[model samples]
Structures are given as structure tokens and as C-alpha cells.
Target: MIKSVWQGKKTFKAQSKFGHDIISDAPTESGGDDNGASPVELMLSGLAGCTGIDVTNIMKERLNDTTKFEITVDDEREDNTSRSVKYVNLIFDIEGEVDLKKLKRAIKLSVDKYCTVAHSLKATIEPKLIYNGNEEEL
Candidate 1:
């Protein structure tokens, strides 16, 4: 579980069950200090982090990595007052010596089987999430 408490104007301190904590604040223009990401950004970050952990663990356990790795996520969503729906467009920048085929499979498996973030989002909106170079559904 997680909890959030009002920290001040447009800001809150959020903590998860394991004691990890972070500040969620609005943009500076919204009277916030801009010290941390907004709540929406945190959701996206959680999606990326969940997928990243899955891929890393899979690669390591399979002895597939021969160098360092990095991942990045890009999204596409528009502001619409008519509905409470949003979608994601994730683009991953995977750099390392891992096999492309295996890596793609790893991503597929992660999105197909292991990613709770994707599952959670899918509960509300249909998210277009891709891994490696393959587009996947949740």
C-alpha cells in the first residue's frame, strides 16, 4: 500500500509500504517548488521502472548482457476535459551487447507476463506500450 500526506501548497509526501518515499509536487507555475515529479509523472516512472527491473533480471539470469544497459520511456497523451482517460507511448532505448532476438522476447515476456504497471494501467485505459522494437498490448 501507499500513503500520501499534504506537505504544503500543491505538494505532498508519498510513501510506499517498504518505506520508500518521494515528494510529489505540482509545477513551479502551480505554486510548487518543482522539487520532484508530479503524480502523473510518478505513474509513468513506475511503469518504466517496473519494466526495467523485469528486463534487467531476465538478461542477467540468462547471461545475456555483455555491457551496461540503459532505458528511456517516451509517452503521448493529450489533455481532454471530456474524459478521464489517457494512453502511453513508450519508446525504449536499450543499449548493450544483449541479443536483439532475446531482448525482444524478454520485453514481450515482461509486458505479457510480468509487468504489473502495464496491468494496472490496462485496468483503466488501453495503453500502447512497446518494448525493444515490438509494440505490445496489455
Candidate 2:
């Protein structure tokens, strides 16, 4: 379970049952102190972290260096009052000697089959690849 308490002036402190704390606040322009990540940013970060863990584990054997693996997530949100997320692009950057096919498969497995956060979202998630420096569509 998760519990959140208002921390005054558009800030909130949320604590999970696992004892992890997440500080969320609005932007200064929105009358907040602009400290910590916003709720939407946290959601996007969760998506990235979830897939990152899955992909790293799935490609453990293929990964030459664990430190070189990274995932960047960019999302677009609706402009309406709700400001719901419309779509998200997951960009994977893996450097070193790893089979592209295997890496792609791992990402697919994470986003399409494994990551619970990915499955929970209503937005469309598109995965992209960046091997070394070249960008490739996935």
C-alpha cells in the first residue's frame, strides 16, 4: 500500500509500504516550490525503470558491460484539462558487443510481456533503439 500526505504549497510526500519515499511537487509556475519530481514525471520514470530492470536481466548474458546500458523515455500528453499521456517513446542505448536481435527481443519481452507498469498504462509505448550512436526504429 501507498500513503501520501500533503506537505503544504503543492507538495506531497508519498511513502510506499516498502518504506520508499517519493516527493512530488508542482512546478514553481504552478505555485509550487518546484522541488522533486512531479507525478507525471514519476509515472514516466517508473515505466523506464521497470523496462530497464527487465531488459538488463533478460540480456544479462549478452551485456558486455552493465554500466553502458541506459533507457530514456519521452512522452507526449494531451493538451486538454486532464493532461493525460497520449504516447511514450522508449529509447534504449546499449554500447559494446551485444546481439541486436537479442537486445530487441529483450525490450519487446519487457514492454509487451513482462513490465507490469507498461501494461498498466493507457498510453501507447513505442520502443526505439540507439546502438552506439546510430538510431534505429524498433
Candidate 3:
């Protein structure tokens, strides 16, 4: 298990000997120094990074020679709430001559089953994915 402790000011610092230090703070609107990424942004980014790694690894394992992998996540929030993410859309741009079928299947497996972050977030949010430069749904 992992544990963290925070002290004074808007800044809270976390450290693990095997991991990089983490710093969190309130947004400028909330009287913080705005020194780090907002919590919501970090959450979305975590999901994107996890799925991106899974997709890239799958492609590489298939000997697809994937050259580039980019994932962009956009979140929509409902009004008058605590700014929780209501919807998340992920766009994956993969560069290589990879089999579209395999790419899609890998992404589906990651988002629907393997990605713990995506799975946890899905309970309180709607998640969608776009794959391989296709405008069609995935």
C-alpha cells in the first residue's frame, strides 16, 4: 500500500522512494498558487496515459512497428455541480501500418477490461473512444 501526508498552505507534497515526488494544490480560483496541474486534469491524464501505454504495447507485441501513439482526452462537466467529469472522449492517433482490427480490439480490451483507471472512472462518467483516425465510433 501507498500513503501520503500533507501540511500547511495550498500545497500538499507526496513522496515515495521508488517514485517521483507528487505535488498538488488548489486552482487559482480557489486561492492556490496554481503551481501544478489541477486534480481533474490529472485524473483524465492518468486514464489517457494508461490506455495509451496498453495500446502501444499491444501494437508492438504484434510486430506492428508502431512509430507514434498519441491520446487526447476531453471531459464535459454538468452545470451547478462540483465540476465532476460527466463525459470523457478519448482520441487515439496511431502512426504505423498496423492492422486496424487488431488496434481496435486492443483498445477495446484496455478500456473495457484492462485499464483500471478507465474502469474506475466509468462508474461516475461516460467514456468514449475514437481509433485510428476514423471518425466512426469505436
For candidate 3, list the clashing residue pairs, or say none.
none
For model 1 the local lDDT of residue 46 reads: 88
What are the per-residue Cα lDDT tens digits for candidate 1 across 23-138?
A: 99989897998878987788888888998888878877654554555555666666775433366766667655668898888888888899998788768555576689899877
lDDT of 3 by residue, 19-134 (tens): 76767778788888777767787788889989987876776666357677789999999786587788999998878778889989989988987888998885665446656775
Model 2 Cα lDDT, one tens digit per residue, 17-89: 9999999999999899998899999999999999998988998877864457778999998999989889999
Candidate 3 structure, TM-score to reference: 0.76
Off by over 4 Å in 1: 61-66, 82-85, 124-138
* Candidate 1: pairs in clash: none
Candidate scoring better on TM-score of 2 and 3? 2
Better candidate by lDDT, 1 or 3: 3
TM-score of 2: 0.84
Q: Local distance difference test, per candidate?
A: 0.78, 0.90, 0.78
Taking all chains together, each candidate's TM-score versus the true structure is 0.77, 0.84, 0.76
Ranking by TM-score: 2, 1, 3
Counted clashes in each candidate structure: 0, 0, 0
| Model 2 poorest 10 in a row by lDDT | 61-70
